[model samples]
Target: MSSATGPEEPDFPAATAARLDGLGLLDTAVTTCRACPRLVAWREEAARVRRRAYRDWDYWARPVPGFGPPDAPLALVGLAPAAHGANRTGRMFTGDPAGDVLYAALHAVGLASRPTSVHRGDGLELHGVRITAPVHCAPPENRPTPAERDTCRPWLARELTLLQPALRAVVVLGGFGWQALLPVLRDAGWELPRPQPVFGHGAEVTLRHTEPGRELHLLGCYHPSRRNTFTGRLTPAMLRAVLARGAGLAGVPCRWRPGTPDT
Candidate 1:
């Protein structure tokens, strides 16, 4: 019953800030992005149609911003938001099956305050971790075309640039994210290895920072989507192992102790 508008380009800040204000400004701008016409249409339609189960819920219907502490040492990148998941809940990986596996593993590894992320204001907290995506909007069929991904890249680039000072490691959820993120990392002053590392479960690559005395570690993990989880391509143990390894490389303590049983 509601009418949706076409996509509008975002107005980036004239200059990037070095502290939290910069991140805050960029996040606000991310939520307002409407650069991809197809994505804007799809996201608005999904919100307007309203899933029968969530008929009473109001959809965010905007670009989903990255979620986590500004100074997080570990950054987790995913492909994009789910139409009925983040699009409905306004938070990355919330109200979805993939989030169920992800938050559980994060909790088990002690990076998350809780084992679940049901909604945006559910008191869930991420310690030394921030979850984001290459594309901010929910796309039809969960796939954003190459043009859409490229159009949405500047937001991720700015976020990483702002986070570089504190970021020591990154965990890419799937091949899409791994590929999308490498260029951003390179532009942010990381010296990526030649031939570029391929994405695989538990794959690790270390890169030297352009800034002296700093380095970054990149870890690849199978996305916690139903396709992978249902097929056993990614197990709880496998996900936890990658998270623990990433934390170690980032020089952060894993809350989940060794031999801790999975929830």
Candidate 2:
């Protein structure tokens, strides 16, 4: 399969992602990937040299995987693991301020079993929702390059492919995640809106799958990152509203109601 110069790019990640059949298998593949040299080195280094507050902690130091049921009807798209967050706790959106805000909102709306996501095996549960990211590793300054996003996209594409049967609503956090996920959705047989919908908080769009009459609703929300939440730009109320809307669209039960306290 190789000429003297080899192919333009080795698509091992994409090829392997396509062969995965289940979320468990996908997790295995994602956590083991070293497809991006820069990411591999960065994630490992962060884990090796942890922050002072977590010096006593052992870091996962590898590519993190999506969390929640394979049959979830709603999915939350994030950017990637925070160095001291998922990288430290081995769970997406865990062990960080971002996780704190997100889990609290999910709990307020009855989408999560607990208000906190401390670590894996903490008895926390998600109802009808799975949370994933475009990239899995911790990038420097919490920003991954374009090349890294593209290299890691196969995992997200495969996840969408596997979840499409049960998935009804997607809640994307931040513009970067929105940008990353549209192509994956398109690849999973959904026709995106012409001109491509731009990302914004409170933005909503519907995508139609190739099968006639099949539809998936998408809602955009600000990333529950510290920058957004700390600045009060993305309040708990704002988060709960978008989450509740997504849950309602996905047919997931919730206790929250519009115009009531956000909880």
Full-model lDDT for every candidate: 0.86, 0.89
> Which window of 10 residues has the lowest lDDT sum in candidate 1?
10-19
As a TM-score, model 1 comes out at 0.92
Question: In candidate 1, what are the lDDT values of residues 1-263, reduced to their tens digit?
Answer: 11232236432221221233477888887887677889999999999998899998889889899999999999999999999999999999998899999999999999999999988888999999999999999999999998888778778888888886899899999999999999888887889888989999989998888778988899999999999999999998889989999998887789665577766
lDDT of 2: 0.89
Candidate 1 clashing pairs?
none
Q: Which candidate gets the maximum lDDT versus the true structure?
A: 2
Please state the error at residue 48 of candidate 1 in Å: 1.3
Distance from true location, Cα of 59 in model 1, Å: 0.6
Top-TM-score candidate index: 2
Least accurate stretch of 10 residues (summed lDDT) in model 2? Answer: 1-10
